[model samples]
Target: MREVDHIEQLVGKLLLLVTPLEDRRLHTDLHNFTHQLSCDRISYSAAALFHIDRSLLTSCIAAIAISIYLVILVEFGLPSLTTSVNNAYGVPNLSEISSYFVCIVMNMYFFVIYLFDIDSTLQGPQKTHTLLSLSLWTGLMVLRLVILAYSSEMVVQEASRTQRLVTKLQMLPVPASSGCQEELLLFEEQLARSPLHYSAAGFFALDLSLLKSFVAAVTTYLVILVQFQIPDTNKE
Candidate 1:
């Protein structure tokens, strides 16, 4: 379908922007990165039943019900009678166990909420477009968040290693302390300029938030489109 094609094109462009590649090495490394993020966004959007355009919410209730049932089943399993014997000594109640399970389920539910909200915001007035811009936006945000988390972990590890190296250098019996001072100064300058030394978490979060706002603007446009649809018969 033309609509499908358009949607695909849009998604491809958005993905390219999210993880732009210049060199072959970086391109190869990031190949799976965009794909994974896209998949996650699609999965989350599907779960929310937001793929349907202009369809009544009730139309997807059955699918939503099945999904909820599956969630419940995974959250709570059958209790073993043999375990009841251990319960005689002391065992957690089903309610307590279910409560913890419900908490996890609720968190998952919120994640789904966040994904849908982000998606709806991104997808503006393009009923002819089937690919779902909101979904793509959600994917980008999630990818950015993941990158921030990973970068933070790397920063922590590198800082610890640098600290250990400095400690070792201090302990070394240097005959000419001047050489050591120069080496330390050079190292400090390198650290200041190094991308690895910079904390990207704040920038990452800010970028994601801006993406969300952009999506929201698109979503508003889409809402207006839906409100003023052209009459099919044009009888009036």
Candidate 2:
């Protein structure tokens, strides 16, 4: 989000720097403005943005670990553990009870990838609250991811908006100096040639569709692990 804000500010500065008409009669300072925008601030911004904390690579690693751990624990661990417990004592199998605990941990994880898995929550009649809580936390994670993507998306939106404004300015029927026209044309070309995007290094674009990809990856791995698990009867 901070990166998005910074890029928008740079683009905004560019737009402001280029949009003014230079009238020699009025003794305007238009000439120096372009140099400041193109040299000092833009160079600094490019240096800062070139390595955005390794961008989404860090995010993908953490998200994959959390998602895979939670799904596998919920789908496989609880049921297997439940059958191992001695239910003859009239105690609720730990399967459902464990899921409740996962729910509790999930709440913490959202505020902090400090999250966890479940088995006790699936612990029979108590499963509802725990299951709902897990779902809610997962939903919150989805929301957080979407917000980040949307924030980055604003850079593109702002760039497009700036381009439109520049084009419209160029089409005006009034007489314009060559410098002003050249500035607009240069900025337009830059915008076209260097479109803004967010991604995991260069693997995939960081958009709403990223959520679907994450889910698909987790599900695929879970299935692969389950398929390769050794059955107790077969082991004998």
Q: Of the candidates shown, which would achieve the greatest TM-score relative to the real structure?
A: 2
Which whole-number lDDT from 0 to 100 does residue 119 have in model 1?
28
lDDT of 1 by residue, 6-102 (tens): 6656656655655443556555545555565546543223445354343435545543554454344323321232233234422232333234334
- Point to the candidate with the largest lDDT: 2
lDDT of 2 by residue, 159-225 (tens): 6897798789667542232244555565566557655555544445655676576566555654444
> After superposition, which runs of candidate 2 have C-alpha atoms over 4 Å from their true positions?
1-122, 225-236
Output the TM-score of candidate 2: 0.41
Q: lDDT for every model? A: 0.43, 0.50
* Residue 159 displacement in candidate 2 (angstroms): 1.6
